[model samples]
Target: MRDDEDLPFVAALYASVRAEELAATGLPEAQQRAFLDQQHRAQHAHYRAHYPTAEWLILEIGGTPIGRLYLDEWKREFRVVDISLVAASRGQGIGGAVLADIIAAAKAAGKGVSIHVEKHNPARRLYERLGFVLAEDKGVYDLMEWDMARPSDQGASEP
Candidate 1:
């Protein structure tokens, strides 16, 4: 991210990710915004502390910020620490395209890509379509993995 300059936009993106869940709480708009801001800070700190070497990138288009991708490379796998897109940019194949690039890169490196996805996340379908499989069930989150070593319905290295 662009540090302080992108703080507000990134926080807003984080809030958008939880907008539906927070809306269900019936909290007033201001309260929801405050809570989401706090949660976003916490998440940012957690990821920074845990994945100190991870690439924290801002997805941009025409010099405008649209999303963020946090990825960590390990010896055997690439961990998608988190990926979030602004509300307006979602459901338009941007995310899928980004993930396909990630998959392709991992395949080239002879490593697997893995992400922890919420069980009900709509993106899970996209991951599945791209050949990610359930590697583990961690309560609310499912760990999905894609490895070039495995046979994929989507031909290997087609990303």
Candidate 2:
């Protein structure tokens, strides 16, 4: 996200993403709100501290912010720190298109792309459709990776 100006929206987006899980906790409404805000702050701070070089971007359509996409490009791979859209925007093709673009760019650069996704996140299906294979099983989360063969690596006719 750009600055303090974007925090409120981002925090709300974060809360929305966690709403389902939070509801399962059966916490009081006010406690849930406070917990969500605290969790959002902690997650934001953690991302900033750990992914210093990542690009923090707000996804917008017609100048209205709808989501966030944070990416960290390393020497041999691009790490998707996080990508999320508002409830109204989920299941739309916006996310698929965004992932396709990122995959294409990774293909062009001969670098792999990776992201950690919750074990049961519905988005796992989308990632699988995009050719991301499970790379690591981290208990609650799985690391998914996508790689494209470079031009030089695609041919084996010459012995």
Candidate 3:
């Protein structure tokens, strides 16, 4: 988000998200860390290339970095490239607040907001509760979307 100045924080954030999965592999600690570093670099490059204009943002609370958000605003849809928070920051309503803002902005622009969420991820419930309907199932992930036309109290600030 802050460019090179944020690389370390971004890498740490990526490592936090993969800690459980990497730990399950039972690999050596050093090897796991190296793997995560490589994967983070690869993902960073991929996103930059694929979504050249996407906004990379750092989510902070009280001046402490808690998460990262990547979004791409297109003519017809606002795409949520990624959103992740540290384990300690989960369930604190931060994600909901950010998502609500995106929904409201999308509604005001007459566009839809879309995100791809893992099928088993707990965040899917939050998206559903916020009026995002399952639009497609892509094996392990599902494409969810919310439009201004949907009848719901969500994105209430729209209009």
Q: What TM-score goes with each of the models?
A: 0.91, 0.91, 0.90
Report the lDDT tens digits of candidate 2 across residue range 35-91. 999999999999999999999889999999989999999999999999999988888
Q: Compare candidates 1 and 2 on lDDT and give the better one.
A: 1
Structure candidate 1, residue pairs in collision = none
Candidate 1's C-alpha runs over 4 A off are 2-4, 155-159
Please, what are the lDDT tens digits per residue for candidate 1 over residues 1-159?
635577778788898899999999999999999999999999889888899889888899899999999999999999999988887788888888888888888988999999999999888877888889999999999999998866356632222
Better of 1 and 3 by TM-score: 1
lDDT of 3 by residue, 1-159 (tens): 736688799899999988898999999999999999999999899888898899999999999999999999999999999999988888878888898889878988999999999888888878877888999999989999987776346532211
Q: Residue 39 CA error for candidate 1 (Å)?
A: 0.8
**Clashing residue pairs in candidate 2, if any?**
none
Q: By summed lDDT, which 10 consecutive residues of candidate 2 come out lowest?
A: 150-159
Per candidate, the number of residue pairs that clash is 0, 0, 0
Clashes of 3: 0
> CA shift at 80, candidate 3, in angstroms?
0.8
